[model samples]
Target: MSDSPSSWPDLATLRDRIDDIDRQLQVLINQRAECAQQVAQSKMAAEGDDTHFYRPEREAQVLRQIMERNQGPLSSEEIARLFREIMSSCLALERPIKVAYLGPEGTFTQQAALKHFGHGAISVPMTAIDEVFREVEAGAVDYGVVPVENSTEGVISHTLDSFMDSSLQICGEVVLRIHQHLMVGENSRPDKISTIYSHASSLAQCRKWLDAHYPHAERVAMPSNAEAARKVKGEWHSAAIAGDMAAELYGLTRLAEKIEDTPDNSTRFLIIGRQEVPPSGDDKTSLMVSMRNQPGALFEVLDPFHRHGVDMTRIESRPSHTGVWNYVFFIDFKGHTASSNVQQVLQDIGEKAADLKILGAYPRGVL
Candidate 1:
């Protein structure tokens, strides 16, 4: 390992070596894919037509192991990402999966879906989170991805509420680091930009940055960042605040990148589907509980978790649609429902709550 250029192989020699490595990689990848096909065949032989090709827990475990064992020139996350696509393509060769996400295209939800399921899986865009759930429930798509919360913007109430009426299970989670940019189309006037368009959340996220840069501009909230990017395509005096995906998709130039007030802004998305995901060692369980409108009702519901040593990660309250209960609490805790401690905690909470709904236990986000 010499730092000197003289000790390095010549350009042609290095390229030839790279070509040899690429050939080896291709052969190994095909071998892995063939193994996956054989695994599918084995399952189909045993389970007949009901064989499920995608296993969220299994995939999560594989990715985690890949990251843990990696000692490479590539970062762990980068290495895991490469393996994710490899596994995704292998899974697709067995049976291609379909994912529905809230989108008009180029939105973060779509990005999350692609990040979690990989580009190998087909992604369908829907108008709303409810529609995403509906499509997964109706068997139109194999899975759905919906935004659960943002680090800067807090929880998405619509997504939490959707779980109350839907029977879909949380199969996995994806965490995407968000980077908002001020973009303008080729036809737009960047110098005299008079109006800015974005989703309400994006506008809020970049409020401080916009105030510092374009305080005089009128802000218009669209249904989505994608729609906002679409709107500025033909406008000479307008810019859109959106992510890189939207800008690239709409062929817009980013005038100001990473414009969000918070430097580490990110969003977490949930994968929903008809089938339940088994324990992946590292897991989280979400629960919707309605406690009796009485003194210490919340404490009573939470005390069991403390006693059982289950780590509660997040808690949010939403007004109950039913007149019988005043409100419902959405709780997320670390650990799978199948674990003995989690089972005990849930049993204890079940006794104290007016209504209890275990949304699903799913693998924690790996990237």
Candidate 2:
């Protein structure tokens, strides 16, 4: 009954103060959401116009500003994620979004989808990249998540090829740092493992580690890393290379962590939707072009970017499928197509190349 200042504060009083703060927060959040509802209504009145639904550029600028001014125990990434959820909730107030990603559940691509869409989104798992695209194109899903490139292994050709025919636009992107774990069932012994299974890319990424440890074990490839984890239930002698989330989902024990060949191995995923996204201040545009199978065709394709002082971030060539000698080039430029310089470069490239298609422009993924 001393009521000393150092005595632990009364539990009921603290709870009441917390409740008051919560009530204020609720009121402010509701006010902000009411503004979102009004924006949605104005958008609907525009008829066939989508300007009010979302603004990627504005969102990116806002996140950058938050990160710049952030001073806290939480990192910029954590702060950005919290804001992303708030923005996602606001967008949901306008309309619920459906997203599709390659999966049977617990795949890395699924994680990327959730990161981009937030937990409020309706996420559907498709079996393949093309399936995700098909769903997006058919309006079965509002967006699709597909892996475009990996740091160690280069591009996913199937994903690039799928873009050749799809009309979907790239609205956003997410980069996930891949950490491979050597997982086994609870009863399994790491030293006694005889075989390992994983997706081809995962296997390749961890090849050196596997060779050093399980030199004699048979390495098998599966459709996905998640499948590999699922296949190792009762076999004490078998292990799988998978992500930490997959291991937890499959109830597998981690024998080793960060088993990838490189410390910085990451995969970039594209967010495909029907609507074009406004420039996110920091944005990247992707395009594919087929040039005449002749000397300097590559130079002709890229010269405009240099002449216009545009930065070319990535350029890869794949077989055109027209013949043995033909090739198609996929390029990633550091600007949006809506910009004047980028527009001029695209116009010049189109006139020079045999074929040119702007895949989509999207916000650059921040690591």
Candidate 3:
């Protein structure tokens, strides 16, 4: 063959250049890991304990600082995600972490678990929320991620109830913006859809849209959105309401995107583990309190927060199962238990309330 007149370089020369680039990247990654190893060593030495391993607070602070200083075409979040994986891998080198979440896979809870632990650690998906907590408490998993509250639907009561007597501590937290999607099989026709399937919560969130479009269609509540998507195979007359990840997992097509009732809908998930996380500068503490059914009883419980200048982020009451007209209040505040102000406030509240339990203290999620 005649020599081709081309703008491209020779194959051998291009291959050599690519090899050199790969070598450089490899070297840089190793150097970063070595530095992380040094950090682990230094932390261990300072504590005078060789058994102590990874420090999540220090790792979070490092990622936050990198995100803060990051200036490039890549956004801070993108940079932080990359560093998160790197640190996760390094931590695995020290000790492999096991995480549990509610799932058969592809659930938002699984996504939150991955967000906290990255791809290096082991993730176990339980069939129920209580199973996640039980796994953590039994030491089957190093951590667990469970839904705490939804911006639109309010708190997940099962998660709260599960923690009432569990010894597991909340080590971290992650908030995921929930974007519901209309998914169908490849052979399914959007206009021909006659029925829909989804978890009760997911169906409720998309109630308005479903009512407008498929008012006459049968709405079936499945165990989970993933299960719903899996049920509708090639039926052109059926559709499922689920997250994008669930659609992808089940090989379904997205008929519509971002179909949630509210644009700002999001769900916050808690990461439960045995160890208590140190303050990440910006942190939140969750507590569940049972107050006596008396006038101004609630005020007396909250008085300590106001006196200490602690900002209350959220307060919601659930019917106490003990008897008629009884209630338990769940409170979230913008401070860590490790902080002096929060410690004093908690002490005061502890003395005033009938019962109080610190659920967890974790870094605030990045919006």
The parts of candidate 3 lying over 4 Å away from their true place are 1-21, 42-52, 151-155, 180-203, 209-259, 319-325
- Candidate 1 lDDT, tens digit per residue, 138-192? 9999999999987655548889989989888999889888899999989877889
- TM-score preference between candidates 1 and 2, better one: 1
Error of 3 at 148 (Å): 1.7
Preferred candidate (lDDT higher): 1 or 2: 1
Best of the candidates, lDDT: 1
* TM-score quality measure for candidate 1: 0.80
Query: How many residue pairs collide in each prediction?
Result: 0, 0, 0
Better of 1 and 3 by lDDT: 1
**How many angstroms is residue 280 displaced in model 1 relative to the true structure, after the best TM-score fit?**
0.9
Any idea what lDDT model 3 has? 0.83
Give the worst 10-residue stretch by lDDT in candidate 1.
149-158
Please, what's the RMSD in Å of model 1? Answer: 5.5
lDDT of each: 0.91, 0.86, 0.83
